[model samples]
Target: MTTVRGTIRSTNTIPADGHGDDQSTARARAVDGLELTGYDVVQTNTLSSTAAGNITVRAVARSTEIQPHEASGPNYGAARAAYLQTIPDGWISLGITVNA
Candidate 1:
């Protein structure tokens, strides 16, 4: 079994109406970065605040793959690359964890 569970905290400057979609897009990119395409979403949460015309958003996404075969381990290198490639501007990863 392989499991990837962690919180991705990020600060962004976005408008209120665009916050939701942007957050969702960020979460999806992070998930794709982890290479958990077929995994289940354990939990997802986001919190946002606005100040000085900038909105800071914190997104946490948890995912898991149960009883995966040998080929199912997380590709950390690729994941990192994907994260770097997909993450939106001004968004950063606070932390992450992976268990297999």
Candidate 2:
């Protein structure tokens, strides 16, 4: 069994060029497995002022444990591959700093 944990920090420039608060959103994914899709949302913070606004989000995600019996598939990598595809497309990962 393996455990995965991470955090996310994001910010955006608002009211750019007098452009009235551009709508924006951010997303973060856990690991590269189907079971890793679900995460516990730790905290989300928003800082706003006359100059700029910022947002910070934190969360923790875990991967599914593989059973010994289930590891004998014809395609050894199929389990992992299936889990990878289960992840949503364009999902942004914010745990780079931790892993890097």
RMSD for each model, in Å, please? 14.2, 14.3
**Tens digit per residue, CA lDDT, model 1, 10-93:** 342221122333556645544444433443444444455344333333333333322211112357655555445554554455
The C-alpha TM-scores of every prediction are 0.28, 0.20
What is the TM-score of candidate 1?
A: 0.28
Residue-level lDDT tens digits of model 2 in 1-100: 2222233222211111111132133223211111333333333223332345332222333322221111112342554343344434433234311110
Clashing pairs in model 2, backbone N/Cα/C closer than 3 A:
none
Lowest-sum lDDT 10-residue window in model 1: 64-73
